[model samples]
Target: MQDRNVYTIQQLSAFSGLTVRTLRHYDDLGLLPARERNSSGHRLYSRSDLLRLQQIMFYRELDVPLSEIAEIVDDPDFSLTEALERHRKRIGAEISRLQKLIATIDTTLHTVNQETMSDRTNEELLYDGFSKEQIEEINAEVDLTYDPAIVAESRKRAKVMTKKEIEAFKIESSDILNGLIAAFRRGAAADSEETLKWIGRHVDTINRFYTPTPEIISGLGDLYVQDPRFTEYYDKHVDGLAAYVRKGMKAYAESMRT
Candidate 1:
């Protein structure tokens, strides 16, 4: 007779939405080892295993590597309560971000409908999420970092672009970012061809604003990490994303130099 307190592998899979093969892989990695086996050698998972699986899934959703997840969950002093608290905080931040985006969409829709015409220009609408103060801060930093002519030219180029062109530009930038995130999640090295390909696309995106030399590209990578605003913007999408982008950009710049 099966233990009432334990579940078979199939039962666990159906409950967790994970494949049987994935469960087997986790067992093989000793990440979520089965409590025991039945008389026929089928794996049986206890309630403890279910709780551990939940932790694994949460970490995975946060882009944590499976190996690191194992080390973390298997740590002698690992605290489920603490981990849950951290997850709650991160989820709250994500919800706030989404709410801001929703507000932006609503504003844009209202302007488009002509029921409430906005005094703000289309170029200003491009930066919907950022406040006027934040935009000024970012512009001030850019002015200090780059040549005045270059900064002016970039702004002029952006101001002259049509609304459709601006939307297309944003879509392309988003696609490149998503590609880079996917590569980072897959454990691709900074200098790997897959990573560099995305970085190359990023360079093309930058060219739409202003031409960038290898030195400029590498310098921009440094800025991404050094500037808190840029770092927060990227890392909000994926933990460690800004650092990963910096490494990839540096590698790409080095390849261009050679």
Candidate 2:
């Protein structure tokens, strides 16, 4: 006859959705000790053991630390009803937090879509993420470095670029600067084919916002090395990046002459 109120380790695993190894670990920890060992010396669990496994899973669902759960469950005065009520309250708070988060996400998405549909200029859309101080700094940088007429003209041109084009321009700009730094690290000559390729990308980026002549490109190269702000911008990425890129752009400008 089959043993009453008993389950083998495998049987308990299939019923409890827990691995035999985990059950064995729980047994070793005195968390879920087996009721008996059968003829083959395999663990056998009683009905009471199955109830304890249910309580363990419930505690786990509430994120109770295993050690704390063990202590609480083993305590003589432990009340399952009290634990369930506490878990319910905590779960309610978590649900409220998640609901608020979802509402916030929905509101932000609606605002972004509305702003996009309102046809804000590319410059507005592009600088949407920047703070007022950062936007002022960028405008100051452009005005300080370029002629007033050129600065005004560049802003007009920037308004025409689509969001995708603006994003591509930013990505290409970063890629060129990073490529120049990498080339410098490898001891590549500023006029080398690969280095010139990066310089070409840099000029293309400039030409997108404002059409730059060879003279303009050459002059800008000097400014990149001389201007502390520009130098800091490039040198932040690599020790001598501003000088390296200045040299590379000068080579490219000379090549344009021929």
Pick the lDDT winner: 1
Root-mean-square deviation (CA) per prediction: 6.3, 17.5
Tell me the tens digit of each residue's lDDT in model 2 across 102-151.
76566557667776445455324443433466568877876776778777
Off by over 4 Å in 1: 1-45, 59-108, 111-152, 163-198, 220-248
Query: Candidate 1 deviates by what RMSD?
Result: 6.3
Candidate of highest TM-score: 1
Work out the TM-score per prediction. Answer: 0.54, 0.46
Global Cα lDDT for candidate 1: 0.88
The segments of candidate 2 whose C-alpha lies over 4 angstroms from its true place after superposition are 1-144
Candidate 1 lDDT, 1-258, residue by residue in tens: 656889999999999988898899899989999989988999999998999999999997776667999999999999999999999999997788677778888777877786555456754664566656767987798777898888888989999999999999999999999998899989999889999999999999899989998899999999998887778778766658899999999999999889
Among all windows of 10 consecutive residues in model 1, the one with the lowest summed lDDT is: 118-127
